[model samples]
Target: MTRAFIFPGQGSQAVGMGQELAKSHSVAREVFQEVDDALGQNLSRLMFEGPIEELTLTENAQPALMAASLAVVRVLEKDGNMDFAKTARFVAGHSLGEYSALTAAGALDLADAARLLKARGLAMQEAVPVGIGAMAALLGLDIGPVEELVAEAQAKSVDGGICVVANDNADGQVVLSGHKEAVEAAIEVAKEKGVKKAMLLPVSAPFHCPLMQPAADVMAEKLTEVVIAPPRVPLVANVTASEVSDPDSIRRLLVEQVTGRVRWRECVLYMGEQGVTELVELGTGKILTGMVRRINREMTGSAVQGSQDIEAFLASL
Candidate 1:
């Protein structure tokens, strides 16, 4: 069956995520070490033995998640003898996970990915003050209704704060991001309009909205210093929800993604339309895999996070 490998973004991280893999596989340990050396910090330690508050910080979580995902990829390659270019039809990621996808497809170096994510996380966090911006998940609402609600909320917002669709996650799940007041306004509007649930997310800053323009600018400069090669396989980008293989395009889209909606549902559907029958999530959690199943029941979704999951997946191949 045709397959596309996917990676998870924020909210997938947790303490002890890659500890078992690092213990079971030498290659996994090397991946974590490479990330630590690249950043001049003991990130692996943070991942394995986290004071959850510090590990969950945007700066730490971004690269930490990538490191965990890459560790799984390295083990799958060494022990499973799997080559992504030969084994998978496409690769994709959500938000920061896009960097992991590019790294996995050999378009980006692991060290470069780590440093870039660190910068991205820092920039995103610093774009807006901690309490100035917010994000909210509006459940049981489609994109069209959510967009209307965003417009209404923006109109009602204090000081004209912006509110917009941040993530069109699934058929019934969408996220809104903007100034805290605007997002809170959206939550109230969503409740008034009879949404199943509307509540603020625990994210530190509003992501994938105009409020993050400053962070996007920072990434634009940061991206220019990095070398991006064409991936061994096509990457389904978050901003475009389509396959892209050109190095220049990938670089450009990475910047846009900082303030652009993560069109995850569309990305999954696009892959399915392109004959991808299975989506394998190689990361810390089964979040993306679960989303894949929600996006299309006909498309099989599986995750390979631990040693046993990796072995089972490889054996299936």
Candidate 2:
């Protein structure tokens, strides 16, 4: 049976994430320290003792999550001799988690991963002004219907209410993003159409839509500064739902992901079809692990978030 290593994206972070790992393992602490050094600040403190609001900021949360994921991986490697090629057949991530996946697969160093995530987070935050854009989750809606709803909402706007489907998260769950008015309108329309739930998301900005074009542009320039190497393992890209490791291709897709739909369900389905019977999430939250269970119930799922979890996994092996 093939195995895959997946990573969680944004929205999975919380205060005190990776705290146990930091306190338990020197290797894990080193990962956090490396990230702090790379960013020239103590992000670990913010993550572990967050003022909540500060850690929730896009700029801090993005790399903070990446650092958490890397810390888990470092502890796993330091405490458990889990071979990447032997233990994992594929690697995939949700949105920002893609950077963690690349770093785990040896495509990028931890320092570069931290730096890139910081750049991405700041760029995305600056893409649109606060409170101007919004995101809503539309349940029980297909992609085609959701796109139609977005178009309808956009058309209803007198100005630029550019509502668009951002994330096709599951079979019937989609996240739409654009102007606040447009998103609210789409929610009302979806509720009228018998959608189970249409609720506004608690996010700093409307991400993964046309409004993120400015962020994509920023990433295009900032990514050129980082040295990206081909992955040691095949990566299931978010855009294509297929495995690719070409450095140029990875760079192109990273920029596109700024405004592209996070095809998470598709990526997991692809891994299952490609013979991944085991999926492990190395990070602060089990969000991606839960999604994988929904996508492929037969696959054995594991989450390594602390030194003890890593040790338990190693013992099992």
Candidate 3:
């Protein structure tokens, strides 16, 4: 079977995400330390013993999730003796998880990835004023109908700020992001469009929409200073829903991702079409795996979060 390694993003983080792995594996511990040193802060402390609110901050959560995924990858390589270059056909991540996928594929240093994510989180958080932007999930509606809903919402929007589909997550789960009033208006419009459910998301900012242009501009400048080498495996970019290995193109896409739709469903479907029979998610949670199931149930999935999960994956291989 052709195997693809995937990584989770934002919402998957928890209070003690990578603590167990760090305790059980020296390699994992080093990964955490390396990230801490790179960021010049004991983010590991915040991750392991979170007050929840602090750890959930966009700046902290972004790097924390990357650290957790990279720790598992380091363990898989050092302890499990798994070589992704030889065993894996492709690598992909959801949203910020894309950085984790790149780090796993050896395109970015752990320290660099940590720093970049920290900057990314801060930029995203500062892009729009609080309460001026919002995001909501519109369930039981496909992309076409959701686009229509967004259009309707935009027309009736109070401030006329753009509202659009931010994440095409799965078959029927699409998330909208933009001006707060527009998003709320979309939710009301979705109900009349026969949507099963439409609810506001608990997010600090409206990400992956036109309103994120300010953040995208910030990334354009920040990413220029970082060295991006071609990854060992291809990454299915969130903005393109296709494999990209060219370093320069990858850099451009990372900037665009700030204000572009996350085509997660299409990314999963494309991998399935490429003969990825088994998808292994390395991170805190199985959210990506669940999305994979929704995109294509025929593709089998596995998750590696801690020592036990890593051991099981190694044994299976």
Candidate 4:
């Protein structure tokens, strides 16, 4: 069976993720050490012993998720007996986790991954003023229907602003972003169309939308500050559901991803078409694992973040 390694993005982060792996394996501990040194702070401590709110901040959440993803990669390398470089067909990640997938496939160094994510997080948070931009989850609505709703909202835009669909996440789950009032209008439109649940997301900014153009510019500048190599395995980019390795293209996509749709459902579909029968999520939570099931019901989904989960996955392999 063809295997693909996937990584989780922002919402998958939890304060205590990867702690058990660190405690069980010296290699996993080293991953945390490297990230701590790279960022010049004890992110590990915050991860293992968090004062919840602090770990939930965008700045911390971004790197923390990457750290967990890379830590699981270390375990699979040093303990789980799966060398992705030797076996996996391809690697892909959802959002910020794209960097983690790049790190796992040896395209970017862990230090650069950690540092870049920090800059990305800070830039995204500062992109739109709080309470101005909003994101709303439109459940039970097909992507086309959500797009229709976004168009309806845009038809009534104020201040030359508009709302747009930001994430085509799953069969019936999509996210919309724009000015707060526009999002509110979209929510009402979705409700009128009998949407199951259209509610505002509690995010610091309206990510994956035009409103995040400032963040995209910031990522463009910061991405150039690092050195990246082509990954050992092909990486399905977020902006395009195709595999890419060119450093310049990678840089360009990183910027586009800031203000572009996540296209997560498409990314997963691409992996499945390439014969990825088993998808392993290497991060703090099983968010991607669950989505993999929704995307392809025949595919098996599992997380390998903790020491026990690592052992179990190794057993299955």
Best of the candidates, lDDT: 1
Give the per-residue lDDT of model 2 (tens digit) for 1-317: 67788898888889999999889888888989999999998999999999989998888988999899888877776667677767788888889999999998899989988988898899999999999999999877778888887777677777767788787776677898888988999898887788888999999899988899999999999889888898878999988889998999999999999998888888888888888888889898887776666666877777888767888877876
lDDT digits (tens) for residues 128-200 of candidate 3: 9999999999889999999987888888876777788999999999999988888888899999878999999
Q: Write the per-residue lDDT of candidate 1 for residues 85-154, one digit (tens) a residue.
A: 8889999999999999999999999999999999999999999888999999989999999999888887
| Candidate 4: Cα lDDT at 217 | 89
TM-scores of the models, in the order given: 0.98, 0.95, 0.98, 0.97
Task: After superposing candidate 1 on the true structure, give the runs of residues whose Cα lies further than 4 Å from its correct spot.
Answer: none
Candidate 2 clashing pairs?
none
* Stronger candidate by lDDT (3 vs 4): 3
What overall lDDT, based on C-alpha atoms, would model 4 receive against the true structure? 0.86
Separately for all candidates shown, the number of backbone clashes (residues 3 or more apart, or on different chains) is 0, 0, 0, 0
Whole-model lDDT, model 2: 0.86
What value does the lDDT take at residue 277 in candidate 2? 87
User: In order, what lDDT does every prediction score?
Assistant: 0.94, 0.86, 0.92, 0.86
lDDT of 2 at 292: 66
